[model samples]
Target: MKNIILLVFFVFHISLFGRNLINPLNKSKDKNFSNIGLYIDGGTFGIGYSTFFNIEKYLSSSKSEKIHLFFRGSYGDVRFLGSGSGGGSFFKNTQTIGASITMITGRGNHHFDSSTGLFYRDESILPLLDLGYRYQKLNGGIILKGKIGILGLGFGMGFSF
Candidate 1:
């Protein structure tokens, strides 16, 4: 079940953003860019494991903001960790796949997952929100980022070109 969802998301990304959406937007500045950065992250809470990462390129839209999109996939192994609701404890893992949109304005960022839900015991689709600040590297790409929400707080490093 997890594998199927991830595969579907990979196909969706290639068809929607990789082949069609971003190319047309980059036709003009095609010569000024090279490659996109890659990222990988994994961490664990008391009884839960979470990971988020993506690889993407930025399509120059205007001078002030950049239109950047990335295919991001996340999987979490969650357990009640301790006594909780109905039962003494519970455990389950969730898989999520979706795309993220970031603005190069340096102030903030946002992302939306078209299909995100849990697997195993409880199942539901819950949209996640990411609020963070990005810093552009002097050479190219992004250097640092920070975001916080129901997912918790995180500090990460990324490359953008």
Candidate 2:
């Protein structure tokens, strides 16, 4: 009688498992799709575009997913960059070209942003620092950012993915 009962229990478990009615792991069907995007930024250095890659997954041991890094370069007109422009400017209309590193932290689509780096124009090098807010999509979509720092105010919008 005990043997018959064991066999019946085994068959029931197999039937439920075969139909995916008893999922033990409960893993999602979608993950690690894509993580990259590009956008245009306008500010003290004029208008320019920047591309960013998501590096949080590689650096974090947990799966929380809340950190990002970016590189920036400026082109066009270096408008208000000059001696009295918070150390990042050097005369108006100066062709500005430089790079910066930005770090972002927070949760969901909202985040706190910070950036620092150096750029050169007209044979002079200047530094930059900014702090502001960022709106980033979870999967991939539109992105917006704003900041105020040593280099003045900056704002930009673009897409990600």
Candidate 3:
């Protein structure tokens, strides 16, 4: 009786958990899902907001990994002071507009992505690079991201849908 019960339980366990172990690449229908979120970063004293878009699922092939594209716009103020007897204070407004492409790799909701791109600031164009990590819940939960780049380093939290 004990041997029969043990065999039955083993079969039942496999039948219950086997489906969850299937490879994601084997699923044709779920291979192309898109996700969007918002993020914020601060280099200077002012805060910056940007939108994040993931196009990897749509563009991925058997040999390619996930890739994402992002666009950002930010505004901040800078103050400068002169030296010596003729010292004076000056304040200026700063703005930046940029775009980037990132390659993402990891498992489940956690990912590490590295990106390189360009930004238009101070009437000229500048190069920007960032290596970041993010945790995004697929079934609707909290989203978090942190990055370090040429501009500076910052962290952001938001919701994923």
Provide the RMSD of all predictions against the true structure, rounded to 1 decimal. Answer: 6.0, 20.1, 18.8
Query: Residue 3's C-alpha lDDT in candidate 2?
Result: 30
Model 1 global lDDT (CA atoms, 0 to 1): 0.45
TM-score result, candidate 1: 0.55
Give all TM-scores, in the order shown.
0.55, 0.56, 0.54
For 77-142, candidate 3 gives per-residue lDDT tens digits of 212232112323232223445545555565568878676776544455678677788786543457
Per-residue lDDT tens digits for candidate 1, residues 27-58, read 45434442454555344434554465655444
Sort by lDDT, best first: 2, 3, 1
Off by over 4 Å in 3: 1-27, 44-91, 138-140
Best by lDDT: 2
Worst lDDT run of 10 residues, candidate 2, spans: 53-62
CA lDDT scores, all candidates in order: 0.45, 0.52, 0.46
For model 2, how does the per-residue alpha-carbon lDDT over 44-154 read when each residue is reduced to its tens digit?
A: 544332222211111111244456554444343345423333554445335555556666777678988877776655467778677999888646778788877765567
True-structure lDDT of candidate 3: 0.46
The superposed Cα distance between candidate 1 and the true structure at residue 122, in angstroms, equals 5.1
Q: Which ranking of candidates, highest TM-score first?
A: 2, 1, 3
Residue 19, candidate 1: how far off, in angstroms? 8.9
Query: Which residue pairs in candidate 1 have backbone atoms (N, alpha carbon, C) closer than 3 angstroms, thus clashing?
Result: 141-160, 142-160
